[model samples]
Target: MGTTVLEEVVRNYRGQPEKLIAALLALQRHYGYLPEPALRVISQELRVPLSKIYGVATFYAQFRLQPRGKHTVCVCLGTACHVRGSEQIFHQLRRELGIEAGETTTDGRFTLEVVSCVGACSMAPIMMIDEDLHGRLDADKALALLTQYRD
Candidate 1:
């Protein structure tokens, strides 16, 4: 049987057991998240158990089982943010994106998430899009932020 591209990724590791993380990262780089078939191929190619692969993937916050949207929107709901009406901002985002917390839009354009604190309370009511932290926002401004990301 021919090795799949996923198995080819595992082979790139050259069978070094210590390269498991590297191998998984390579796979994720190719396909947004760790696809199920790739995981199985990795297990077979590296002689590593599928359970261990899942364990490692889940242990790292950087790894994701589900595909992420082009944009990741995280709203901070810390006390400072909440006091500044972060809840309203979050709701506005949900309405604008048509996606509830932790859900990606059907078109895979955006993902909405809520975080208790992002250590940016000084900014208060912050919404982070990808790596950009947007603070001191009103509901309208927050909704407006989505415009630049729209197609």
Candidate 2:
């Protein structure tokens, strides 16, 4: 293709130390995680310390230095979600996937994480499988939803 996403991110924000956070976010978006090589490039181009860049990356929950699975499964454990039996759905997912929260499956197809909220309280007991929002889920429904993503 054309210039790689990392190249674009670096070139667009080259020598702009103040834009480090934005640059890291852009790189994360492009690759789903921050690749170490990209970080080195950012350090060299932006003239910023690699330690500083890494500090910012580790400070934010949104950033992932390691590669995430193809799909991210976020379960809402907010007050409303908990009240609506989200734990039951979470249990189902854990059982079916054989992985607990904060762990990825052996196949690298799914990563299960628990979040405080997805900001959709009205649709409590919700989970997000990638970009799709699934609300009003039960044990069976959660398992079925996960099944479709295996492909």
Candidate 3:
């Protein structure tokens, strides 16, 4: 995002440094991730150093620095999922997508990530694509599920 949309967001917060996190959040919602240039705009408008702004962005896991993919693949790694072989499923996804955790595929179709839990222990060995949760999966089954989303 350039100064145009970001400026509007900053203007909403009255350009207050105290509102940095809130401003960043609004921007994140708009762009899906915090663009580097967008951060510069926030720094200048709020009179906060870019380094400090970066600190806040990186400090929060909710803030993403890179662009998000069309689909997000989050593999559950909590104790319940782990015992059921979530790791194998995660590795298989990484291998198939050719992108490591927190990375989007080259085609920008998918992003792979690992999560501690999703509160569905009964559905052990779970991986989610976008907002849909799939459970009780083996590595092969996980790959098969991904195929459905390829289109």
Candidate 4:
């Protein structure tokens, strides 16, 4: 809605080409998603081409061109996790978040994603809250884990 953060970030960008990624990261941190208007503003402020900006955004997994949720829930769907009931975990999260894979919640509180593996096979059926991994999840355990973040 406002342009203060965007302007401030553009002002801090050095002339170096490498600063492009840093600038995008700052924008994402401020806005949660890279809106088209914001992208245009960034291009104008930095004097960088729009194509370059789009390229940088596309290159990075962290930069979301679309909206993202406040909390990201990543469930591992690796072989071990699958055998240990990760599908059930995925279902539970989808039902609780009210959004399918790669979607943010209506309230913008949570985003659900399924990853191929999280490397916690011993504790299969793991879900990560941001970077913190919770392992050995059953339906009840998963539900309880989600409750901790609910308003």
| TM-scores of all predicted structures | 0.86, 0.83, 0.93, 0.85
Model 1: colliding residue pairs = none
Error of 4 at 97 (Å): 2.0
The TM-score obtained by model 4 is 0.85
Name model 1 segments beyond 4 Å from true: 1-8
Query: What is the full ranking by lDDT, best candidate first?
Result: 3, 2, 1, 4
Which 10 residues in a row give candidate 1 its minimum summed lDDT?
Answer: 10-19
lDDT of each: 0.87, 0.91, 0.92, 0.86
TM-score of model 2 (CA atoms): 0.83
Question: What local lDDT does model 4 show for residue 1?
Answer: 71
Clashes of each: 0, 0, 0, 0
Rate residue 114 of model 1 by lDDT. 92
Please list the Cα RMSD from the true structure of every candidate, rounded to 1 decimal place: 2.8, 2.2, 2.2, 2.7
- Model 2, position 82, has a per-residue lDDT of 98
Best by lDDT: 3
> How far off is residue 144 in model 2, in Å?
1.2
Ranking by TM-score: 3, 1, 4, 2
Q: Report how far off residue 30 is in candidate 2 (Å).
A: 1.8
Worst 10 residues of 4 by lDDT: 10-19
lDDT over C-alpha atoms for residue 88 of model 4: 92
- Tens digit of per-residue lDDT, candidate 4, span 116-142: 989889999899987778998887898
Model 4: CA > 4 A from native:
1-3, 14-18
Q: For candidate 2, give the lDDT.
A: 0.91
Task: List, residue by residue over 68-118, the lDDT tens digit for candidate 1.
Answer: 899999999999999999999998888888889978999999989999999
Candidate 3 lDDT over 68-124, as tens digits, reads: 999999999999999999999998898899999999998989999999999999989
